[model samples]
Target: EVAPQCRTASAAGFFAVAMYYQGADHASFRPLCPAIVEPQHYVREEPLFSSMAAGERRAVRRRRLGWFAHQVHQNSRTLIGGWVTGLFGAIATVPMVARILAPRLTSQIRESMGSLVRPPATELHLERLGNNPGSDPESMGYSLDEMSQIVVRILQDIGMVKDFPPTIVFFGHGSGSLNNPHESAYNCGACSGGRGGPNARAFAMMANDPRVRRRVSQLGIELPDEVRFVGAYHNTCNDDVDYYDLDLLPRSHRELFRGIESDIIETRARNAHERSRRFESAPLGLTPQEALEHVEERAEDLSQARPEYNHATNTLVTVGRRDWSRGLFMDRRAFVTEYDPAVDDKDGHILTRILQAAIPVCGGISLEYYFSTVDVEGYGCGSKLPHNVASMVGVMTGAASDLRPGLSQQMVEIHEPMRILFVIETTAEMLSRIIVENEGIRRMVEGNWVQLAIIDPSNSAIQRYVDGHFEPHLVSDMQLPTVQSSMRWYRGQRDHLGFATIQEPESDQPMNSSESNASAAGALA
Candidate 1:
């Protein structure tokens, strides 16, 4: 009974080590009984060899570092003199280099580069204007016409051109923590690890303008006079939502805003409750309000290693209407983007724009988590327990070490390392064309860096893209458990919970006879 399982486990471990050594970047291993250990005789000797190999690699790394340090110490004077000379030479040639590159360094070029010489690289925490337009007038901000277009595009993209809500809240998300050097890791990736509140506030202010609204109406998407746009910031670490420009709110809209605020308060408590399940320090029996308070304290605590698991366990990105995924428990593992194919042109211009940002950003985040989780010491920055912020440049181990570029162990402790799955609401043909045309998207999909699937907008059917072709995915017949509320489903659980539908008392459906019989049989057994 256990021999096959032991063999499978050994093979899986061997394959994983082989894949790692061979540089098979995308390979993943799943053991049949990962938590169970076989008898010593049942285990294989391959893992011992792999461990020795790992030790050798570590020794090699240490030798290289030692050699560099020895050279630096022996030739300190020569190296320092050479560095000084080079610095001075570069300073002296700055005028010449600037003059030579003057023609190439145009205002348009600078604007395109986000007014910086180098592009924003999240690995180094460099800030950029991201996909959304920023408040910087010349470099990142947009004109009135551009803002109107953005408004229309947002509406059309989200399938909200008609039936506009009275008060539309644009919520920008960021994190809050005390005495955490890697605080930026918890902020919005779209904003280049900066607070996104300003972006949301700017967009809301622009959309609320009568002039922008007039132009948008001329473009065929009319906003009612009563419609108002409100900007808000969500502190993910503390689970708090704060509204901006409330003083500018109309007298008539006060009641509506108040109701929205109430709903947000309730949502914050529930969200905190869901997130609290992952924290060992948090009690499983905590109420929603208690969970909220617990998370709030975590944000403010100086000793909190994990203000929150930033992007951990992110497995999928779904680009489509909210209706398809509504009422489904996502377990906070999916990034949902609003896109309406019905409103898109045949050329899929809107979809293309969305993917241009979505594919790279989401894929980058997923890959970062994947690598960090797979080899925490080698790929990741290692444990942040002894990390020190060096001169505000980056994090270093102990007092001095190499600047760690990847995530910390606390951030990726619970992450499941796998290539991210991208589910888009579009036809297979459109997706194929997208994959073919966009070089970045092509490399990611074709190279198997990300898994692709298209969901039919008409019937909500899914077709996975595999080996350059779309294969229809078989829908499962298994039913998700039902509960009256999230608390009912999550109560007394301190580990990962499966999906369960929350329903009102009246709408809760009774289990079918077949499932009931199966349950009875299992219980009896």
Candidate 2:
């Protein structure tokens, strides 16, 4: 049913996606559903194979490259003397050779500076987030009746009935930057992109096991011996949170884990003053403790060129109920998935696994930021200001050609290339039998890549999806301006503004946004 001009992933919207790197289950990032099928073997069983192998499907060619093992532990005269010192135009001795041999190098000078930058990995010191013994994939780790039918089917795919949320706090997002080569495409795309802190420290050690909470209250779903599933780690690139099991949290839930870590350190300083209004050397109206110490020193600035705009204007993905995209404004551009579509009455079965994992993880992160912001030098892999992490798997520019995978150009230059609207709730005949029984959610609803819609999880009847059905997406009501916070409706505003009905959020006074103004031309769905 797709066809709003083939939805996007081409004509400069990128997604040539050929994906491999299977095993650690993100099962090769769906594009032609990993060449036909094996959607995590319908919820896991060590997928030795289900799809990917018609001579192993191909296409993601940006000159196939993948170095890291300490970037080919250098040789060939220390990789032609660091490409003849980046072509004799030394560029200010590359940040003083990236700050004094980036911490006393040697594993043979870190395989000669990890062949020109970015190699740090250590620190897993996991004291206890427990249940380790053989960490089963099938010697059968998941059976207390398969972890209570995978915790009552992910609490009926996020609708959650009988108990939880006194302190469920799974959070588990991830992404770090420095010399970013799409840092595992800024992680947590259902941990295929990886780092959802060991799947939220292994689902808070299998929902605080007492034999999986007595097989999740013998499947009636109750979980509350002073309910405590913490395991955190937000860092959705520098928004930084971290918790993880806190030695199995319960001294009667330590004052509800110190009031949910002071409302997540005041929502990570109002999400770093809404990502320091898209960082122009941050520091304006400061205080969310000076914009969380300027985004914890721009997540340790390796010549910081926007380290934290990781998902940059991600564009509305609402699965359902943050009571309908919360108090209006969503400039931290919505990916909100709570889901409650009346717990599936019309057989949408948790709205078809929340649109089969939010239509390829929010349409593969909005067609990989709308083809890396509509082509930043051939589907983006340009600009991280003269990138060179050539061997540590990807990114290459100064030290030769080829090996330029997507995302860069200062991370899709403020990114707004569109295509992901996705807004689901339920209906339109249970979303057209989940868009005619999934051919990978009908090739992302017939290649309009992602735009589908629905709304009414009992009221505001929106609709959208087109060319092959559903309609009424009209909008027009009024009473906008509300604020009391969003740092006083974007304190010292930078630009792109819209949607204001805030009514609470008070770091002295601020701003979903049917977002427009980042210099509006489109986006309303």
Candidate 3:
């Protein structure tokens, strides 16, 4: 019946392809199948094969699998087999060997390491400047004035001194994953391999105090009585948020807090949907709610290999106002630190302090991903499947391999190895002075470890810094693709997406999945 239908077909570009081996007629019809099509019919247009050798007329160019493809096909099975074998062998032999020599080996191990002396643990000392009140260790705690200054410095650093929101949330981010050896590597680097929740909670507590607010007002900034500060910890792996000090919130502010919480829930669901595109295991057709559930499962799943691609594909770091790059889809690749140039002084002192934290932390993260992607086995800790936690400090390849550092193959799998580009919205002269004044910044910029570019705060004109001079970066005439929303652009795709101007709906009401898909399809058409 299919053969008769194929023979009677009258469509201009109709073709039939074979599937079964037992059908000889289907095999004969394969010659009519199209191998390529016009760009109008196909999603993309590119050559199927390329010349193996360059500048040679008679070079053979057969299609071959990529290195990553080959590894996925061959290396995965071998790694799993080796891991399983090692697991059972250790389980069978280790208990018996320990039982046989438990009494004797304990004495021998202690005697062999008798000369080792543990070093003294260092205690942190916080001393107030312009005061000679302390040779005593007991006077190291921060005073009320010092605490107020800290709050002022934080507000200045983030450029949020004025126009306080009714409900302000300070979110300290970290990761949560089970059965992962390098979990600490995914936490906030600014917190010295620890979660930043404590610091954020402390800051919020201090800022909310009436006494601290009075001191802050005296120092130059004032907080309104209606403004309430909330501290929250964000799990980057699962998109779960935990807010602190909820009981302390006033009854009048409960409704406002609920609204904020709802907004956060929606934001995390959208964020999870975006992250799901990078996970090969995640279905492209997943709804935002389903994507959230998928990531929550990955955090708890023991057999999962890639729990979260931490800091992967990070290439751009923007240090300026949020409005400069607002509505621009960075595809979760840029680390945005909000800073207003108008808030800074003529000497760019505020900008200097912002970059002092931004450059080192963001640059270090980018470099780590760069090196790990370039050489996964050498620079990275290899595959996470075979990793073993050693000494409760680091991960080893197996039971007795050397301690591995850097990122793992699972973490950097989707990463594109490149030096991070730092785009700062400031004048060239101010940035040049900062580079000269700061040695660390100078080394990173001059050594070509990270690329630098400055955008004019007044006109948004960009200048690329090269050889100690600023050159105007040429802008192309091409315009970015416009979409109704980010979900409309990113849905049903699993590759790296480009920048687009998101023209969201003017209404404050949210759209359901069906409405979103219909709008997206209209845009695509």
Candidate 1 deviant stretches above 4 angstroms: 1-141, 504-525
How displaced is residue 505 in candidate 2, in Å?
13
Candidate 3 local lDDT, 274-342, one digit each (tens): 999989889999998999988887776656778798688898988777666767788888877766788
**Better by lDDT, candidate 2 or 1:** 1
* Backbone steric clashes in candidate 1, count: 0
| Candidate achieving the largest TM-score | 3
Clashing pairs in 3: none
Candidate 2 lDDT for residue 399? 75
| Local distance difference test, each candidate | 0.65, 0.57, 0.65
Question: How many residue pairs clash per model?
Answer: 0, 13, 0
Q: Candidate 1 overall Cα lDDT vs. reference?
A: 0.65
Candidate 3 structure lDDT: 0.65
lDDT, candidate 1, 1-525, per-residue tens: 101101000001110000001011112221111122111111111112324555445445656666887875566469686686565666756544443344224323434753222211111001123444332322233446766876776666556677565677777677877658888877766545555554455556667889889999999898988778776678888888877667778997787677557656877898898899999899888888999988877775555788898678998888887666655666778787777788899999989977776777678789989998999998999999999999878999998899998899999999999999989999999999988999988999999999999998878788999899999999786688877666777677765567777563331345432212110000000
lDDT of 1 at 283: 84
TM-score of 1: 0.70
